[model samples]
Target: MNRDLREFRRLERLCLEQAALSTMDLARTGLLKVADDCRAAAEAIEARSPPRGAFAGAVQALKRAPLAWRVGARS
Candidate 1:
């Protein structure tokens, strides 16, 4: 997963550079296609990974915590 992310980042950067230098429509379109492909690949990877963030962590912890402990907690 890490390696795939790195590769996608690299390809995305390369495509951006090529797109900038491209003077013709066909070349720019090709670079845009490559960039879109990299974006899709990255999205696919992220979808398979568990959610991240404080809310997600709290939800996960709540799921793992005992029901008695959860109900007994005071605010």
Candidate 2:
């Protein structure tokens, strides 16, 4: 799960660098928050869908966050 999260985060960063994703997009599409939401998301995602497990977990949790980290990110 941790490895999956790391890869997810890497891809998220990649998107940010490319300016293709906003903070909301990161929280939604990448399904992640590196600093605070990581652990809870990992566990919840694993519990709900063990088949995709880590990947799905990350995406699920990412969908739930407020995305307060980047205000006006799309602008």
TM-score of each: 0.65, 0.30
- Candidate 1 clashes between residue pairs 3 or more apart in a chain or in different chains: none
Off by over 4 Å in 2: 20-75
TM-score of 1: 0.65
lDDT of each: 0.79, 0.52
Put down candidate 2 lDDT per residue, 1-75, tens digits, no spaces: 657766655665664454444556545445434422554445454445554667776775675453433434645
Q: Which predicted model would earn the best lDDT? A: 1
Clashing pairs in 2: 45-57
Model 1 segments beyond 4 Å from truth?
Answer: 52-75
